[model samples]
Each structure stands twice: as structure tokens, then as C-alpha cells.
Target: MQELSNRTSAFTDSVIRRMTRISDQYGAVNLSQGFPDFDPPKEILTRLAEVSMEGPHQYATTWGAQNFREALAHKQEHFSGMKINPNTEIVVTCGSTEAMMAAMMAITNPGDKVIIFSPFYENYGADTILSGAEPIYVPLIPPEFNFDANVLEAAFKQGAKALILCNPSNPCGKVFTRKELQIIADLAIKYDAYVITDEVYEHIVYEPYEHIYMATLPGMRERTITCSSLSKTYSITGWRLGYVIALERIIDRVKKVHDFLTVGAAAPLMEAAAVGLDFGDNYYKELQNHYTHMRNLFLKGLDDIGLKYITPQGAYYVMVDVSEFRCKNDIEFCEWLAKEVKVGAVPGSTFFKENVNHLIRLHFAKRDETLQLALDNLSEIHIKAKKR
Candidate 1:
């Protein structure tokens, strides 16, 4: 065969999804992928059932259905303290995955440099490559997952055209505080760069740690492209309902890119998820409580077993330290964990640009019984794989 495109050649299959398959193969309790094992909100499900028969089954507008976008605008404004125009400022996408990709395509030219934090969600790396942009990785130093402002400013000084911000960050579970976000906002303004955000866990944040929207920061609304989804918030990952919110000028470009990418998000799914977008603050409060309960249950189990892991302030994931196990390669260790320990986890290396391999990422987004099973399996790790 002729040579394939180099754009995709460097990409491996998603480590998260692969671990899910490994979990299935081994009958391990799957915590590697971050979807809930439970059903979505009953209100969303009920609306979906109604929409099934009422029928708008065909594609909606290239951007989104009018009602869905309006609901999204209302929801975002309610939380972010920024008013948004539903017509000109939003582009509904297949999911935040597409939202991020479309945002990259809209803003980036080949050979441009985009700043990405190390230990990021893996897709950000691929998105840069696919967009033909070179990535400048600024390490978010581990343990506390804080960045040195000087290091970050250096990346901006190097002519970075954009930066990807994942608040309530994945894999590491670091939620950027408002002060930290303000610093980033200042840097972005000083450098004349865009901030493309992945705020998928916006509503799933724990207490004492809040999700602050970059668009709401001073001098940032025009330069911030907010990519978020109903998947994580509504527990409807299969629905693939997500959107990009930016100033009208940026959103116009995103709409064109999004239109060519997927035509539009699913119509019936958008209608159903609008109900979720319209949900009151009480619903979000209850969501935080539920996730808090799950986090406590799973991490308490790890604590009881005498395992070491980072306690996340916001997101549902926890990074367990495996340095004591003496595993040279995190990938091999994760495979062994799946097969022998019967608990699947993502190798921490998959999410980092650095040579990090002493940690493994697991999520607690499952039901109580499911988490208990994974915890039971994990409790035997010392006996099964500990280096003598």
C-alpha cells in the first residue's frame, strides 16, 4: 500500500478505551474509563423517551437546535456570570471531543505553537498534531499539580498561539483555583493567545473547589473558547451532546469547522439534554453530593488497604502511587493489574509528556457495588505484584 498520512501515525489507540477492553477481557471492575455505570438522570431519560416518539430524528441545524442552544446559553450564563447569545456564540458538536478539535481547527495554522500542560488528557496532544500545531508542554508539577508561573510565562513568550486548559483536569484531578486562572488570563492577554478550555467536569466538582470559567475572567471573554459536554454532567456519554461557546467571531469559525466535521450533534439527543441544561441548582448540588459519596467510598477503601493515592479536590479520578511496586513500565503494570489483580487502571505515562511512570489513574464513577468490587481486587495488589 501507499504511505499513510503521518498525522495519525504517531497516535496510539486511546489508553482509556483500551483499558476498558482489557477490563472486559479479564472481568475486572472497569475504572480506567471515566463513564458512570449507572443510568443518566431520570428526567433526561424520560425526555429522551418522549423525543423518540415525537420525532426530530433527523439532523438539526448545522450549529444546533434553537431551543437547545438557548438552554445551553442560559445554563452557562447562570454559572459563569457572562451573558451569551445563543445564535451567534454557540456551536453544538458531537461531543467536547469534537468541540476541542473544531476549536483547534478554527484557530490554528500549521506550525503554530500551542501550550499544553504536561499530564494532560491524551486527546489534547493528538488535537495539536491533527491541527498541525507544535505543542509546548509546561509541566504541572505533581503531588500538588501546581505550575510555576515563570515556566508558564516562558511558554507564552516562546510565541505560543494558544493554550489548552482542562479545569478539574483529567488523570491528575487538579482544579485550577480562581487566582491561578487569573494569572493564566493575564498571561494569555499579554501574549495575545487563545485559551481553549475542556470543562467537561464543570458540574462534577467537589466542595471547596469551584470551576471558574476562563471566559469570565477579565479581558478573556473574546479569547476564550469554552468546550464542554452534557456527557459528564448528565451521565449521558452515549448522547454525544456538547458545544463550544466563544465570542461570535470565533464561534463563526468553529461553526464552519464543526459543520464539516459532523454536520451537527444528534437532534433527539440535543432535545433531551436541553432538559438537563434547564435543571436547577439543586440538581447540581445533588450531583456533587453523589460524586462525593463515591469518592469517599473508593478512596477510603484504598486508605484502608494502606495504598497511597492523591486526594482530588474536585474531579472523580485519583492517581495511585505505584513507585513502591518497582514497575519499570506503567503499561505493563496496568496490564498485570487488569489480569492478576482484576482491577483496570490507565497508566499514568499515557497522559504525560514527561517520562512519568510511577503512578496509575483510576476513577470512582461507578455504582457503590462496582466500586466495592474494584476496591476488593485492589486490596490484594501488595501480594500479587509487589516487587520482593
Candidate 2:
């Protein structure tokens, strides 16, 4: 075969998914993929069981189930202070994965330029490529992942059509401050470009820090296309429920693309997830507490082992600098880590458009025992590992 499609050449298999396979192979404690190992809230499971027998078992409206969309609209309004018309501005898709794809298709054209912050979630690379848009990667400098306003403004000045903002970003796990979001909002408004946001970790922020929805910014509501999922918030990653909130005009276009991409999200899962969306404020606060404890516990373990890593402010991942330990190739190091150390991590190279590879990424979304097991294994990183 000469080639299957131009899109197929853009990326290899997702490194995060590959880490999961390696974790199983070596019987390693898996803290690579960002999914909660514990069971989702029991209410969702019971609701799902009820819905399966009850007959919305068939296809939902191509956009979304009515109840799910309505619930989502209310939840989003409560959090972001923006009123969304469920019928016009929302589309329920299989996951934020599909929502992102539909959004890219809705907004981008061939050869168009889309600016993305580097050290991005690996999916953003493939999404831009498959949508036939060229990505202009603006590097988010290390430790503290922040971008320069001038640098961002320059990307827009060069005819970029959209900027993909991943708040509470994956891999690096830095949440954008409200002031930072305002800067991006200013640039998008200045250039008349769209802002496609991935905010799946919206509710997972550490205390005192808050998740500011990009759409909530002045003039941003009409221009921002928000793609988020129930996967992170509800701990139901397998359920594959996500939605997009956009201006009605953009939603109309995204709905058309989404209708063909996934047809609709799974009906029963949608019905069950509605329970999660309408959950009380205390539920989210508790979720934050759980994650905060995990973050501190995991960091404590890392500290004891003398590992250097960024402290995550939001999301469940941290990217550790592996250069000091003399790891030349991250892929080889991660393989060694899995087979020998019995711990799995994703090579950070795959997440970058820049060519620096002195790091690897890990997630902290496991039971306390599992985190301890990984930490215990990682303690020996300095012992058996070769030093530069």
C-alpha cells in the first residue's frame, strides 16, 4: 500500500495508550493513562442498569439526548456563569475526543494555521493534522508552564485561524490563570479567530486555585468552542460521554460534522451521566479533596526518592525532568522503567513539537496503595539506573 490516507502519516499510536499495554505486560503499577482505577460513582452504575432495560437503548437525537444536554447546560451555567441554550449550542458526542474532532472540522480549512501550546496533550497534534490544518506550536516554558503574550500575539499575526487552549492542561498539568486567559481572549478577538478549548479537568483543581472557563471571558463566549468530557469529572472514562458548547452558528456546523462522526453518544451512558452533571456542589468539592490528597501523597513519595518534578496545580499528571539522570532516549528509558522498575510512564517527547526530550510524563490517578507501589518501585531509579 502506497499510503492509506494523508492523516495516517501524521502521528504514530498514542503514547499514553502504549504505556497502558506496557504496564500490563510487566505487571507494573499503571499510573500512565489518566483514568481513575477505582469504580465510578455508584449512582451512575445503577442508573445505567435501569436505562439499559428501559428502552432509550436505541439511538439518541444525533446531537445528543435531550435530558443529557439539558443537564449539561445547567451544570455549565452553574460553573461558568454563562447561560447556554441546550437545544442550539450543545452537541453530545462519544467523548471530548469526538467533540474536538468535530470542532476542528467545523472551524478549520486546509492549510489553515492553528496555534497550540507545546507540551500539549498528544491528541491535539493528531486532531490538527487530520483536520488538514498546520499547527503553529508556541512553547510553554518549563517548570511553570506559561506563554509570553507577544509570542502568542505573533502566532495570530501570522494568519492563524484558531488557537487550541488546553486549560488545566494534560501531561504538564498547569491551569491557566484568569489573567492568562484574558490575554489569549484579547488576541483571539484582535485577530478574529476561534478559541478551541479542552477543559476536561475543570473540576480537578487544587483548593484556592480555580478553573476559569475560557468562554466566560468578555467577548470569548461567542468565539470560544469548549470541548470537555464526563470522563474526568465523573470518573467514567469508559463511558465516553463529552459535549461541546459553542455559539449557535458554530454549534450548527459542529453538529453536522458530529452527526456523521459518532452519530450520537451512547444513549444509556448519556442517561446515566446526567446524574453526574446534576450532582451537588459538595460532590465537586469532595472530588477536589480526593485529588488533592492523591497529589500530595504522590508528591511526597517522589520527594522522598529525590526526584525532580513539577508540582501539578490541576489535572492528575506531572512531567518529570529525566535529563539529570542521563536518560538519553525517553522511549528506551520508559521501556526499561516498565520492564525493570515495574512502573509505566509515557515518554514526554511524543507530546512536544519542540525537540527537547529530557523528560517523561506520569499520571497520579490510582488508589493510595497503587501510588505507594509505584513510588516504592521508583525509589530504585537512582540505584540500578545508569548515570550520565
Candidate 3:
């Protein structure tokens, strides 16, 4: 047998998914993966059932279905304050995962450098590597999860071809603010670099912290590539309907990359999810309220349990500090948490490019009962999770 590709030889199974398996094995309340344990919106579900019977069950088009794209464009315009040409500016993908991968492939060449913030979503690192590009990591300082403008400009000064921005970031759950995004937009413009934004949690922002579209920032519309999905907004993670919105010039390349990658997103799923795209502002307001309730419910339980964590501003994930447990490693502590505490979490080290192991990431995107149960199980952590 020939040698395996070095591009992926060093890869380990995703710590998040691996923890989910461990949680299942131990019958622990799984919070390792960030999906809701509740049902999607009733309207979307009803549409899905109807689409199942009267089917566009086969492929729609290489880019996307006309109705789906038009609906997405209308919805995007309603929120983003920008005109979008559904035919030329959008490429529907299997998911934001594919949307991101296709966008990276379209824009990067071997040896190109992409600036990625530290403690990023695990996939971004792999995406840069698989695109044959190098990553320049700039740390988003903890506790507040803010980055220094000077350090960021230093990363840009390294001739970075692009920057990956994950707003309402995963693992840490820090929402990038408008001023912060403007700093990024300025640097990107100064360096003539592309800004690839992952805004999946665009509608799940809590009060006082707004979700600003990076593309909406001054001088960014042309160079920004927006990759988002219906998964988080509509609670349809399995539907895998996502898309990339960019200038027609960039989207042309992305369309080719996406077409060869997955052909197109599922036609029936797209049709069903298109209903969600047309949802009025009230739907988003309710979504924010629902996630806000979940966040408060879960964090309040943590407060009662005397656990210290970084309060999330936008996303549903919280980084729980476990340095008091005196564990040898975060990975071991997480495993023990699943087996003994009966709750699942991902080691904070899995998401960091630096040496950070005193934290663990847990999500609150579940039913109130499910979150309460996890909290009930976690209440014993102080004693049960004590290091040997």
C-alpha cells in the first residue's frame, strides 16, 4: 500500500463527535455536539412533509433551485441591507461545511496564507490545510475573547490571502462587535485580502450584542464571502442546506467548486427550508428569545452549581473553567465527566491552536428539560470529578 496523504495523516477524529459517542456509551446527557434536542419550527416541518409527497426529490440545479435562491436572496436582503442577485451571487451547498470548503478551494492556492483566530472552530484549521494553505493564528484573548488590533494587523502583514471570521464563535461563543468587525474590514482592505465569514448563528444573538454582517462593513462588500446555513437558524442540522453569497466574480469560481463538490443541495430539503427563508422578522425575534431562554436556563444552573464560566454573548456554547478540578489534562477530564459526571463536553484544547487546557466547551441548545437534566447530572461534578 502506498503512503497515506500527508494532508490528512495527522488528523484525529473530531473531539466533539468523539465525545458524543462516549456520552452515548455512558448514557450521559450529550452536550458535546451543538444541535438542539428540540424540534424545528412548525412551519418548516409542515413544508417538509408536503415536499416529501409532492417532490422535487431529485437534484434541483448545480448551483441551486430558483425558488430557494430567490427566497434566500429576499431574506438576506431583508437583514443585510444589500441587493443580491439570486442567479449569479449564490451557490447552494450541502451545508455550510461544504460552502466553506468550496469557498476556500475557489480562493486559495497551495502555500497561500489564511489568517485564523485562535480557539477557532476545529474545521477551519483543517479547511486551510486541505486547501493547501498555511494558517496564521491570532489569538482571541480569553475571558473577554477580544483580539488586539495590532496583533491582527501583524497577521495581515504576513501577506495573508484571506481571514476566516466565525461570528458568534463556537466553543467560546464570542460575538464579534461592529467596531471589531470594522477593524477587521479596514485591515482586510489595507492588505487586499478576502474575508471569509461564518455567520451560522446570525439570528441567535442575545440582547445588547448584535450580529453584524462582515460583508455589510464599509469597503468589504466586494471582498467578503459569506457562508451560512439554514441549520442553526431553522434547527435543521440534518437538512444540510447552506449557501455562499459573494460577488458574481467570486461566486463564479465558487459555483464550479461547489458543483463538482456535491452537485447541489437536496432539492426537496431546499424547497422545504425555503419556507424558513421567507419567515418574517417575528420568527427571528422568537428564535433569539428561545436561545436566550436556553442560555439563561443552562447558565443559571451552572451558577447554582458554583461553576465559573465565560458568559456567552451570542452563541449557545459556554466555556466552563475546570482548573479547580486539578485534572492532568482536559481530554481526560472530559472523558471522566462523561463517564462519572454523566454529562458530555469537548476539551477546550481541541479548538485552540495554542496550549489551552483548563477549559471545556458545552452547549445549551437543547430543550429546557434536557438542559435541566444535564445540570442535574453536572451538579455532582465538584465531588465526582475530583482528580485521583
Candidate 4:
């Protein structure tokens, strides 16, 4: 066989998904992946069943269905306090994964450099590579998961064409405060670079850590390309319904890229998720409460097991310290943990650009019973998975 595409020659399959497979092979409680084991909202499921038979199984507009975009625009406007033009500013993609890719392709040239915070969601690395952009990683130092403005500004000084901001960040689960966001907004303005935000956890924030839209910051409305989805918010990960919201000019290019990429999100799914987007404030309030309960339950279990972890301020993920174990690396530790301890987790090293190897990420998005089971398995980590 001929040599494969050089651009992807060095690519490895996703570590997160790989751990999930290992978990299944061992019949371990699979907390490696972030998807919830519970059901989506019943109302959306009911609508989906209706749509399956009613029609619109064919593709909707290349951008999105009319009702979907309208609903999304209204929801976004309600939260961000910015007027959104559904007709021109939104292009629903396969998921936030594709939305990020489309936004990168639309804004960047092959050699352009993009800034990404370390301990980022894994896909951001792939998105940069696939878009043929060079990545300048700035570390969000652990424990508190805070970044140094000087380091960030230095990346911008190197002529970064854009920065990928994953607020309510994955792996570390640090929600960017308003001050931190203002600093980023200021740098983006000064550097004249675009800000591509992945705010998928916008509605899952815990108390005292609110999610602030980057586009809501002064001078950011035109420069921020918001990529988010209904997957996390509405628990419809399989639906693959996500969108990019930006100025008409940016979205015009994204629409072209999205059209060539996946054409459009599934029409029936879009119709169903539109019902979710139109949900009232009460729905969001209850959503936050439920996530908070799950977070508390899982954290309490970790505490009882004598495990140390960072408390997530927004997202459903928690990073637990495993340095007390004598493992050679986190990857091996996670494997042993799954097989011997009967629980699964992603090696924290997989999410970092630095040489971080002493942490593993577990998610609390599962049902209460599932979390209990995982914790029960994890209680044995000190005994079974500890390397001698």
C-alpha cells in the first residue's frame, strides 16, 4: 500500500475511546468516556419518535432547519444577551466536534498558528492538526487550573491566528472566571486573533462558577466563534446536533465548510432537539441541580475512599490524583485500574501537553447507581492497582 496522508501519519486513535474499549473488555464500570448512561429528556425523545414517522427524514437546509436555528438563536440570545440572526449566523454541524473543525478550517490557513490551553479536550489537538494549523500550547497549571497571562500573551505575540477556549474545561474542569475571560478577550483584541470557544458545558456549571460567553465580552462579538451543542446540555449525544455561532461573515465560510463536511445535522434530530432548545428557564435550573447532585455524590464517594481530586467547577469530569500509587505511567495505571479494580478512567496524560502523568479523569455524568458502583470498585485502587 502507498504511504497514507502525511498530515495524519502520526495520529493515534483517541485515548478516551481506547480506554472505553478496555473497560468493556474487562467488564469494568466505564467512566472513561463522558457520555451519560442515562436517558435524554423524555420530551425530546417523544418528539424524535414523532419525527421518525412524520417526515423530514431528508436533509434540511445546508445550514440548518428553520425551526432549529430559530430555537437555537433564541436560546443563545437569552443567555448571552446578544441579538442573533438565525438566518445568517448559525450553521449546525454534525456535533461540536465537527463545528470546531469547520470553524478552524474556515478561519485558518495551513501554516497558521492557533493557541490552545493544555489539559484541553483531546479533539482540539486533532482539529488543529487536521486544519493544518500549528498549535502553541499554553498550560493551565494544575490544582487551580489557572493560566498565566504572560504565557498566554507570549503565545499571542507569536502571531497566533486564533485561540481555542474550552470554558468549563475538560479533564481539569476549571470554569474560566469573568476576570480570566476578560484577560483573554483583551489579548484577542490586542493580537487581532479570533476566539473559537467550545462552551458545550455552558448549562452544566456548578454554583459560584458561572459560564460567561466570550462573545458577550466587550469587543468580542465579531471575533468570537462559539461552537456548542445540545449533546451535553440536553443529553442527546447520539443526535450529533451542534452549531457554530459567529458573525455572518465568519459563518458564511463555516457554512461552506459544514456543507462539504457533513452537509447538515440530521433533520429529524434537529426537529426533536428544537423542542429542547425552547425549554423554559425551569428546565435549565433543574438541569444544573441534577448535575450538582451527581457531582456531590461522586465527590463524597472519592472522599470516603481517601482519593484526592480536583473539584470541578462546571463540567461533569473530575481529575483524581494517583501519585500515591507507584505506577510507571498513568496509561498503565488506568489499564490496571480497569482490569483489577473494575473501574475505568482516562489517563490524565492524554489530555495534557505537558509531562503530566499522575492524574486520571473520571466523569460523574452517569446514574447515581453507576457512580456508586464505580466508586465501590475504586475503593480497592490502593490495594489492587498499586504498583510495588
* TM-score quality measure for candidate 1: 0.98
Error in Å for residue 165 of model 3: 0.1
lDDT of 2 by residue, 1-388 (tens): 6667867765688888999899899998887888888888999889888988985888999999999899999999999899999999999989999999999999999999999999898888789899999999999988888898999999999999999988899978899998999999999999999999999999999867789999988899899999999999989998899989998999999999998887999987898889988899999989999999999999999889998899888999988888876777888888888988889999999888888678888899889998999999999888868542
TM-score for each model: 0.98, 0.98, 0.99, 0.99
Off by over 4 Å in 3: none
Tell me how far the alpha carbon of residue 320 in candidate 2 is from the true structure, in angstroms, after superposition. 1.4
The lDDT of model 1 is 0.93
Instruction: Please provide, for model 1 over 30-67, each residue's C-alpha lDDT reduced to its tens digit, 9 standing for 90 to 100.
Output: 88999999999999889999999997999799999999
Candidate 2's C-alpha runs over 4 A off are 386-388
lDDT of 4: 0.93
- For candidate 3, write residues 1-388 as lDDT tens digits: 9999999987888889999999999999999999998899898899989998999888798999999999999999999999999999999999999999999999999999999998899999999999999999999999999999999999999999999999989878899988899999999999999999999998988989889899988899999999999999999998898899999999999999998888888999988888889989999999999999999999999999999999999878999998888766999889999999899999999999999989999999999889999999999988775545
Q: What's the CA error at residue 388 for candidate 4, in Å?
A: 6.0
lDDT of each: 0.93, 0.90, 0.93, 0.93
For candidate 2, report its TM-score.
Answer: 0.98
lDDT tens readout by residue for model 4, 252-304: 99999999999888998999889999999999999999999999999999999
